[model samples]
Target: MARAATATATATASCAPRLLRAALLLLLLVAATRRAAGAPVVSELRCQCLQTVQGIHQKNIQSVKVTPAGSHCAQTEVIATLKNGQKACLNPAAPMVKKMIDRMLNKGSTN
Candidate 1:
């Protein structure tokens, strides 16, 4: 009976470390998963715009966002937010968008 008790204790002692290590690994994975879930989502991996418009009236535009060419996109993108809350992708090569970009640049430089 004494030998059996000692052998049982020995087995439990060896198993305790492995069980603790597994518990720690599980906790780390859960924490990592929660952090990844909390992180901001990137809606699209590629460019946001696929089609482009020729022009838009300055009065109709409430805001403009310009994205430069990079790994995600090959060409410059110009997006205009209209007063009605609609977003339109403008052609970067379009005269109106180019002028708008120039105006925005000049305005920024003066500030």
Candidate 2:
């Protein structure tokens, strides 16, 4: 009985480090997943716009591209391409764009 108790204690001692290591590894994986989930994937916005004249004629504007130009600590540059292929920049540095990106990024976190 004494021998069995000693063997059991030694076995548990050996398992303790392994258990601790496993827990640490699991914690690291969870941290990594959380970080990855928070990271944003770059994307381009594509859409069409229409204008009506005389309440009858319809014009189709094809493929407006919205691209990210740069990212600062608090803001980013979003370039908006017009239907005529002209490009304009919408800066997150702007109050409206900043709020929009903030809301978008926040909404992203919930998913």
Candidate 3:
């Protein structure tokens, strides 16, 4: 009876480390996959925002013009005329920027 009890205790103690390691490995794998899956979406959004800003700068824009809704953009886009009188497109997803755009639209409509 004493030997059986000792063997059972030994087995449980040895199994604990293996169980802990397996659980740790499972958690790491899940975290890695989640990060990998979501990374592209985050990067793409940043890329699109930067690209839109770059395009606007390249055109040497003057004042920004906002449309309540746009045919080409996801939400609203800002149109600006350059010193050379060329039009440029700007993204309006940022909070502060969107507010400014709303003000611009409202002010324009009033006049």
By lDDT, the best candidate is 1
The alpha-carbon RMSD values of the candidates against the true structure, listed in the order shown, are 5.5, 14.2, 12.6
- Candidate 2 lDDT over residue span 29-81, tens digit each: 99999988876564423322222122111133232233343342222335444
Local distance difference test scores for all models: 0.93, 0.54, 0.65
lDDT tens readout by residue for model 3, 12-102: 9999999999999999999999988877642223122224453443335567766554333355556667888766566566555566567
Q: For model 1, what is the error of residue 94's alpha carbon versus the real structure, in angstroms, after optimal superposition?
A: 0.4
The deviation in Å at residue 1 for candidate 3 is 1.0
Q: How does residue 18 of candidate 1 score in lDDT?
A: 100
- TM-score of each model, in listed order: 0.66, 0.36, 0.41
Q: Roughly what TM-score does model 3 have, to 2 decimal places?
A: 0.41
Candidate 3 regions off by >4 Å?
43-73, 77-111
How large an RMSD does model 1 have?
5.5
Which candidate wins on TM-score?
1
Superior by lDDT: candidate 2 or candidate 3: 3
Error of 3 at 65 (Å): 11
